[model samples]
Target chain A: MDEMTIIFSAFLNGMGIVFTVPVFSAMMIGIVAGMIVGLIPGLGGLVAHILLIPFALQLGDPLAAIAMLLGVYAVTSQTDSIPAVMLGVPGTAAALATSLDGYPMAKRGEAGRALSASYFASIFGTLVATVIFILFLPLLRALVTKFSSPEFFMMVVLGLVMAASLSGRSQARGLLMAGLGLILSTVGQAPGTGDPRFIGPFLYLWEGVPIIPVLLGLFGVPEIIDLAARNRSIATSAPVKKVSGLWLGMVDCVKDWWLILRCSVIGVVTGFIPGLGGTVAEWMCYANAVASDKDKDSFGKGNVRGIIAPETGTAAHLPGAVIPTVAFGVPGNPPMAVLLGVFVILGVRPGQEMLTYKLDETFMMVNVITVGNIIAAALCLVFQKYLVKLCYVRASLMVPFILAAMVIGAGFSRLSLGDIAFFAGAGIAGYVFKHLDWPRVPLVMGLILGGIAEPYFFASIDRYGISWLYARPIVLVLEVMIIFMLFSTPIKAFAARLWKSGVRSEGSKHGDNT
Target chain B: MAITPENNLQPVDRNQSIAFGRRVDWIVSMIILIIGIAFIIMLQSLPGRATIFPWFITISIVFITATYVYGKYRNKAVWDELYDPDTKDGDEMADTGPAFVLAHRRGVLISLGSFLLVVAMTMVLGPEYAVPLFVFGSLLARKENWILAVLSGIGLWVIIHFVFGDMMRINVPVGFLFGGFN
Candidate 1:
């Protein structure tokens, strides 16, 4: 078939799948669940994704399952702002920037305006990201055809390096966790030889450590522990009496179309990088907003642009993050790492297959993001006042319920008692890691990619011997990219210093001239 | 950084917390180094091809961890910056009052203990009994009202029984005492 015809057909097929009863219904459920989770401080889409994985697996339809998860992923940036605006407690890490200006607005009784502006900005951001994603698909399709085992191996390495370097201030620590993850992935039987490496008398280890339990333990338990320790409601303030200026907020977003577009683009670019995720995107956009504005001092004091920039950027980031995940199986962020795991479980291979045979499914995911965001924004607009109450639900009330869900979710992974034990162990480790400022994302990326990396490593070696390192053009290119990514931070820092010095010199010279 | 209400830690407490965190980091790095060494030792038993990747990873772990430890030791500024609250972004520095710290430590223990207890309970009494009991016990322990705890427990039971048991048809364990239901 012609490219255009294939694209059109895939688009239709994607819409058809999305509109199906099971998929559409599940998406709605996911959207609502995401909103609830997003409103609750400390519990974000990652937790929701981990908790729902077992259920999504049970649903038995990949499209429905993924659509449901994507629904959760897409709308979080919208509802997470609710808590950020109302209570100054960001519901998710990405909402931290939103809370900066959002809380000030709420304190000024423009909570409705800030929220509605965020909602609309998020909607526009997702729409812009979707367009960018669509435009990139053709180019990605062309690029993915050149990938092979050696290239794939290097791609995974590049992803790990990028994640490790960018995830935390300490690249060495991040790499250590990643190395540990790779080692852990070796627990199962060796790929070709079928000999167990670290089974240690446990029969279940033959399949390797289950992803679900580990994910829950690593991400979910730590947050729950922290919340329980804090031992209070998420919101200390009374819920807003009535939300007003929502229309004004929407109008403001419309008037600030250029800002929304610019920030959305920033978000997409940031999102395309492996470890630079929604938090970075939002903050960068917020900084940009502050820098470009004439009355920068007015920011952090109820500036609407502050709300618009971050929200748009963060909303745009989700789809941008999905691109590398869909095209290369390299997750753009931690949550995408979990989503990529689900995609694997659903019998979907990312990379070339996603671009070729499974293009329709990719389009389906895009559609879910688009439709999910629209529904989420509408729901938030209508239920703004009611949703604010979720922020006030006591952590004491939430902990047990979330704990129950975690236990059940972990157990369902393998129907094994061993999984729960693993979960508990991982949770403890995760809590420590969180407190110690260790980056967890690289570890997750390493764990998920480890299984895939090993086989590709062996395959490349077997097929081309060590010459595969230099034999393939793409592999060589990837090697350079990996090295560059490892040192990008220092390079950027050096350049920034140079730029600052140059600017300072120019200013001094100008003063002398005056 | 976002001006959340949670950023209320006193400067002294925050500095102390950072010190404590640095100590923990040192301890964790040492533990990782030891583990990596042990793994390298363990990799000796595997066949050549099977051991290749593990050996690479194990050695990488050892090398990377050693480098991290050495770098931190050699560089005081970097070491300080590693746990410096001012250098960090995203999550606020955790409150580190003595009482809150103790409570936090207790909370971590309870969280882990409760999970393990649930697992043990699941093995002995089955999820049907274990889940509700856990919800009830946890809620009450957390000082929630008894009526609400009971209702929450009951509500959880209905969901587990209906959603997971009947609808999904997961073969939930029926308890060792009651004759395990697989």
Candidate 2:
């Protein structure tokens, strides 16, 4: 079939999912489930996606499973924007940057506006990303093929360098955190050599550092401190009325089209990268927004664009991840990979034979993006108001529940007392970093990327010789991009600059009185 | 006690030598470089194909140490804020009330302290015990509502049991204390 035919058929498949078979109802269910799951502290998208996997499997077809999973996936991120905004806790790293602005916005009685803007922006960003991904699939397919080990190694190095440079007060502190992360990741038996660095006698540590608990510590614990330090009265402010307005939200979105579009693109592109996930995408884009804005002071002070960047960056990752799944058969995220495993078990592959010969696989791929995006949008439009009410649920009332969940999630993740210590340690480091105006994301990012990079680095160098990097053009391009990341301000910095200019018009009130 | 913001940084005990802490930083870097270089030397002594990381990391550490040395020539107050509590940026945001100042300071302490508490609690409680205990205690530390704390604890327990035990099948141990009564 021609490219136009594929697009037409995909567009039709999207329409089928959107209008027929109660897409609205599924989205409504998804919105509620997502909000509840996101508020559960450490669980976030991984848990929600894991729980939905069995159900998606029961549907027994690539498209149905994907549609259902996408419904869950899309709303998970949008809802995550909530607790982070109103309560200062985040569902995942994706919501980390959101809390910087969203929580402050909530304290200022614009919680409704913050939630509403993110909800719409999420839908908008996902749609825009979907369009871009669909158009760019062939190019993306061509791009991933050019990545050899040396290039991959170089890419990892660049990300590590950029992460250290962009993060913390100095490169020393950033590298130290990264070094610490590398040590923590080395706890389990080595992936290649089976040498466990620091597991001691515990079998739990034998598998290595647990992702979820580290997540709870890095993101969850600091929020707990913030909540505890604030007196109980911050939660009991008189509720802001006059929040309901569909038309007003639509108008607000129109004015911010450029922002929503740019951030969505950033999120999708980052998602397309193999190891860099939604968390990095959201943060990088949020920072990008701050960097590009002329009004630099408005970012953490409650700019709607700040909230939108992460929510959209993350939401778009659903479709963005789907690209890798359909194009290369590799899952781009933790939970999505689990679902993708089920797909392979049920007989799905993305090799040349699948794309060139298997019409059904191609159809399934198209439906995944177009159909899934609509399902997510319908859910957002219908249930955004109730999710906003969560912002008003008295931050005091929500704290006890969230705090309890965070500890449980951390404790249960590793099945060892040591894991808690790690979480606590990371949290302590996080607190000190925050107070000192240091960035904690680099530490987490280092751990995430470091664990994956070392093995790849050793193997690639041995197989291809040192010169293997120049042989792979895609790898060369990535290496160049990393160089840019090293020298330049992050995409987030640009976004922040643009955001500052917008807020200068509203006046940089320098942190709200509320 | 309050001088102009510019002079607020004048001589805590007089002398720029205090900022030489960066030299300690450089010395630490040098030591790391030496240790790494020694490892490479030992590897070359052994029957192996000489790896790249030791040299790579050692050189990088050396470079950072050199940067630290270069940074040390003057302006000690700028590089080493960790040792100097006398610095003004600690608790002084404009227009923030006394309550905010206190909360912000305590926020720093709580964040730092919670990290330690988790380590201690884990040592005594193990994961299953530690998870619930820490969850409850952390919640209890906030907002002073015991009822919500209990409910959240129950909720956390159920979810962890489901996610870790049933779904992911990652093992979590029960310590000999608390629920270890099993």
Candidate 3:
């Protein structure tokens, strides 16, 4: 009858799959599996995405496939924060920022409430972002199509500047780290020249360093070192109290609405943008929320807001990423791209009929997301208290298992020794980087986005010739951002300071930003 | 640059250790820089195909790291921790044990040992054999309680053997130790 009715109808139709027996079971299975994966460290989105393929193919129904896949993908960020808040270890890249406050909250006996905040923020963020995505799907698609290499290059420049600007300390070193990341990203395969760089016996090096391994080594290894260094001074705080009210926790979401809202928008926008993905959004939002907070002292030690930022950002991506995927058939994120493969295998076209809302197919797509979220969230609400207890396990008990799992997870992903070796090598390098006062996040981010940027930068060059860089306004804008970052007073100072401090300095503010 | 105690590296022996540790620190970082440079050089030597990004990155990184190493520390920050254990905190927090003893805890060594074991196993038996074996073995080795270790070991075995291997149709290589039995 009207646009509201059409939207409501779409929501209901999309949710109708919950009534089907197979879809219901699939939803539960997906959510539970996602939660488990999210609880374990080093098993990230990439691993989960890989794991979903075989199971997704088995499901066969495009609707069921979408439901299960999205359900698992959606809840991962939420469940991941459980471990982060309680254990001081993150299960995914996005949840990493959560550990800053989450673990601190646990140590302060607010683990339950903090965990509660994470789940609520995620659900609220996803729903709000999803609605916005559906409402603006048409306009967003048209806008993205206007983008060419110049726009993408500008976006990368923007992403680097934003990341640098947001890092908050030692601008010079932060800019240097970002530049180093971009430069390193250019390794292995020169995007413009197709020339290979420092590849060795490690053929995988040809693709540049594996970001996952680096992430594991830099963040995960350093954390392990901290735990080992602080062995006896383990948390003396009382365990978090579990109350009988899900509604109470849900209201906590209302108190921090602005924070969650900002993180959600941040997550959705970054997730929707090609290549920038959840990790950057999570870290940026987490840091921003902390910087903006009046109670900043409780941040890295533990706070509710810290836990919420990254969790909300990551989950918001469920809906945020779906816009580009469903409307344009251009997968905005890795998980969405893999999910598209399942859609293809199931003989369903992603964008054709879904946007118009004419076919039941669009309904099926929505059904999958809604069904999955409901099942996962419902279970989590029921078990939040018990799940929060997992945070108290001693690092000694967890370290061995974590190491085994990381090695196994990395090894299993590609079914190769090379991956494990690469992972270990990355971990050592990461450890060394920490000691040497080098920033590692930019290095990993650069590698992840480098491969993608290369082909596009090259294609654009070949298509319009080298003049294309100057021809486009967007490219010119990006050029300005890059130059601004390089020469900024704060940036130059940080780099010089970092070089001055070297490994024996107080980790100088220079390396801490990103 | 002010050398706040927090910036110091741990695990350096005290006494004559400062000079020796300084030498070790320089050597270790220098060796890493060299390896990185050599990696770049190897990539450069590869025949007429496109792939210069990796080498360029390695070279630049090595150069930067070498420069950082050359200028940063007058001496290794080893004794900085042992003598001044309350390094970072302006407040005095007494150690329950020696600093190095604490750093060399079972949790630390087991994890490091697991990494080396996996690398060695992978070299000897290949990845397929190494992944599951290492997974089960490391968990079994690191956990103090036998029951938990056994359960975790079996749990890991079932998942790797059944879920990943049988159902998912992924092939894990046979270990050299088990080649004769299977």
| Chain A TM-scores in order | 0.93, 0.61, 0.62
Evaluate all candidate structures by whole-model CA lDDT and list the values in order: 0.82, 0.57, 0.58
Query: How well does candidate 2 score on lDDT at residue B175?
Result: 56
State the DockQ of every prediction: 0.41, 0.19, 0.20
- Model 1 alpha-carbon drift over 4 Å, by segment: A107-109, A488-514, B1-19, B84-116, B173-182
Q: Give a tens-digit lDDT track for model 2, residues A77-189.
A: 76676666656666466777787887777777676677667777777777787688667855654565555556555655665665566444466556655554544544455
lDDT of 3 by residue, B90-147 (tens): 2112111223333354544655665677766765665445555665664555456767
Worst 10 residues of 1 chain A by lDDT: A233-242
DockQ of candidate 1 against the true complex:
0.41
User: Considering lDDT, which of the candidate structures 1 and 3 is the better prediction for this target?
Assistant: 1
Question: What's the TM for model 3?
Answer: 0.64
Q: Provide the RMSD of all predictions against the true structure, rounded to 1 decimal.
A: 4.4, 10.3, 9.2
Which structure among the candidates has the greatest TM-score?
1
Clashing pairs in 1: none
Write candidate 1's Cα lDDT for A398-506 as tens digits. 8888888888888788876777778878888887787676888888888888887888889888989999888788988989998887677768867997999999999
Docking quality of model 2: it rates as incorrect
Report the lDDT of model 2 for residue A510.
52
lDDT of 3 at A204: 60
